[model samples]
Target: MSSKAYRVALSASGAALGAIAAYWALLAARQGHILFDTRKLPVVALSGDFSTYSHTVPGGMVRGYVYHPHGEAALQDLFVYFAGRGEDVRATAKALHWLPEGFGFAAVNYRGMADSEGHPSEIASVADAVQLANHLRKAFPHARLHVVGRSLGSGVAIQLVAQQKFSSLQLITPYDSMLEVAKKRFPLVPLSLLLRHQFNSLAHCIGVAAKTQVLLAERDDVVLPERSAKLIAAWPTPVSVRTIAGSDHHSIIGFEETWLLLVDFALTAVLAMPEAV
Candidate 1:
């Protein structure tokens, strides 16, 4: 081909690459919104006595709910829960019924969700977790604390565990990283380069020392079965893996068996620490 023709071809290829790069950048900028669904939902009455708590963070305040066992006056054991994206934690007040008596239950609403203020981002959420954990630790010095996270919250939980020690750690339908999930969904995009909020749970798991349990949905399609498998394989600490039968991504939490397994794991140390698979 002539030199002029070759130059023209090269110019066209460069223009195409620039366009793709711009598109990826736009996607990256909107990642936070895509990752966090903060829509407010109808509030449901809690089963037992509970109190609302709030903590100030950069930009705004983070709100959450705490439930106490029927007869308990002191914090015997604490359970800190992190719900999935798009979940209105106020609706999760019903979960208090499933928790073993004597355990204090707490769940946080991400920024801009429900009564919480400010915008939500990966960094801000993790920072808020740390702040909340520290506050709870000081408030109940003698209580044994356990952390439970579902879906997107799993990433936040892992990061918290890496920085703080807990009695136990529970993850439900977690992913290795948001970047990995994005890559799977948008294979042609350069997510690794453009992703701004990369919640790399696999990296965060390396330093977690707490006894861990991973609950996987048998038919998970949102996070993918392989993604959860990858995190389980990469976990440095001993972790017990259990699958909820006949459950998918959205329906897994609705099963009675799911709550039974979680409550049992949280309340007892009978779960043998199997070697990481």
Candidate 2:
């Protein structure tokens, strides 16, 4: 209870606050580089069902590409995909060969990734993805839109769903909150306070109008199976969860077990269809 000690502690706290404010100011001035790493990834536009282009899209232009079968049913809604951290559209396209033939897919480089412009190296760029999805839905009024996200992408997708009403939502290896993920990444940081971007999906899960498909990579090292299970616990039943058996985080894309589960989930989980009149 020494008055001298209390004064020193108070002074130190003020200095800490000043330093944090300065660091955050530097981050704020740097616009879209939130997620863009500037490392170019291979973009393969398929002859029939897939095409790649760097377009200026809603919420700032981004580098993105689309994929579909040569004769895919145009009636089917589009799949707007979000990829994992330190990853881009190339991973999904390459994994396409592993997937069944049906549906269309678009994987975008969020603002600041690869050839994408703007300033981003964090999940704040997810706001841009949400805007892009809304624009896509409005642009293709006829095509019912669906959004799918993987790994770190699940956080981006959750934000989009919270903001936009989509046909369906697919989340793979999703964490409960960005705070949970930040804590996993940085045990030293006081995750509750230090984390600025909390894409708290659980808080908004009830607002999701879209029927969801939860895909958990079995034995996943990157994102534990428990995380997906936890999210599904409160979600609607008939709310399906598919386990990519014998698959891990990095290998899920290529594993036969993973693709089989996805094929069933993708083909079966159509968003909006009329029931009995």
Candidate 3:
């Protein structure tokens, strides 16, 4: 081939590679935006009084509310809660009524959500959870620590349980990983290569030693039932699975049976390890 012909061929190849690179970059950005919807949801008014809780992370502060049982119960057990992606956790204070007596609740608002600061990413959110869990451990040295995570927060809880010792871990409508969910939603996108926030809870479950309980929605539209089943099967530790009949993703938490299962599991776990409390 002539030199001019060779140069033209090289230029064509460069252009093709450039187009592929640009497409990958765009896909990554789009996936990140959709995965981490940081826009704050409207806070609902909470019915009960709650104490302010804050933890300083690398970039900013993670703040939320702490709820105690009505009377002097000595706060024997503590539940560190991570709410769903769209959840306005300030309202979680009102849900403290569902918890058994002698249990304290700490609901953490993810960074960039509500009054919390910094951008929301899977790494940052998990780091914030670690900081908050560490703080709670020190604050309630005598209390047995338990974790409850719903939806996106379940990913965070899985990571936390892998790192810290929790009396019990409860996951509500969780997925195997954000990447798997993204792949299901946007099949055309190369999620394995372009996805940034792959919150792989299934991988994290391998190291979790807590008494794990998973609550599944019968008709979960957000996290498909198969993904939850995969996570359950992949768990190395024994996990209790409970499906709420006729409940969807958002409405399952509203069911009284949901809270009853959580309360019973936590109580049973705490009671089993009475020395921890």
Candidate 4:
């Protein structure tokens, strides 16, 4: 080959390689922003029956809220919540009245989100969930524990349920895997290779015995209907799937029907279990 022709070809190849490297590096460096979107959130004031709870995690302290309907000693059914991306979980305090009189609720900010400290990642989030579950189990030994996860939280919920048995699980607008979602958006980029916190909820569905309920939004463009359907298909046991009409990813969880379904599902799961001696 001619020297000039070879030099031009080499330059073209070098440019392509440089562009690809920059793309990979950009994604790698900005992963925390893309995944967690950690930011300073408003401080949630403790009031009524709500109280602040803190736990020592890997990097730092994780703070959250706990609602004791009948005080700590009289805890009934406990609903542990994992919130969607950038969702202020303190908002859960407002929905306490929707639950039964005896029900309790608890939610923690993901590491680096809201009041929580430390960096947020899939591994750290799941580890924090395990710690939270153990703490709650010891605190409310008699209360049947149920889980509610929305959007990104669904991945955490699925992984938690797989490791530690929960009475029931309610997943709102969940996706099978974050990796899959990324692939759809960036078909050319090798997300599987670049991504670190790929929350693969579908893979963890094996052996999960929890009674599951999935709420889907009819017009969900974020997680998309197909991704949710894939997760539903992979569930070990039969899943109760409900698609709310005239709703998108964020709004579906706000619907009155959605709350009713969550409450009813929690109650039904507990009722289905044989009486605890």
Q: Against the true structure, whose TM-score is highest?
A: 4
Question: Pairs clashing in candidate 3?
Answer: none
Q: What does the lDDT read for residue 140 in candidate 4?
A: 79
User: In model 3, which regions exceed 4 Å deviation?
Assistant: 1-27, 30-33, 71-73
Which tens-of-lDDT digit does each residue in 100-197 have in candidate 3? 77778887787777778766788888888888887777777777888999999899999989998889999999999988877777776577877878
Per-residue lDDT tens digits for candidate 1, residues 206-229, read 989888899999998799988999
Per-residue lDDT tens digits for candidate 2, residues 163-268, read 7766678887887776665556556545575455566777767667667788777787556656666778866435777777777776666666655665555555
lDDT of 1: 0.82
Each model's lDDT comes to 0.82, 0.64, 0.81, 0.85
Higher-TM-score candidate of 1 and 3: 3
lDDT tens digits, residues 1-277, model 4? 8999999999999999999889889988888666877878777666778877788876789988889857887777788999998877886566567666777888899988988888889998889888888888887788888888999999999999989878899999999999998787778888888899999898888858889999999898889889999999988999999988888988876677877788889888888984421
How high is the lDDT of residue 24 in model 1?
Answer: 78
TM-score of model 3 vs. true structure? 0.86
Each model's total of backbone clashes: 0, 17, 0, 0
For model 2, where is the 10-residue window of minimal lDDT? Answer: 268-277
| Per-model TM-score versus the true fold | 0.85, 0.73, 0.86, 0.89
Q: Residue 240, candidate 2: how far off, in angstroms?
A: 1.4
Give the CA lDDT, 0 to 100, for residue 161 in model 4.
92
Relative to the true structure, candidate 4 reaches a TM of: 0.89
Model 4 lDDT on a 0 to 1 scale: 0.85
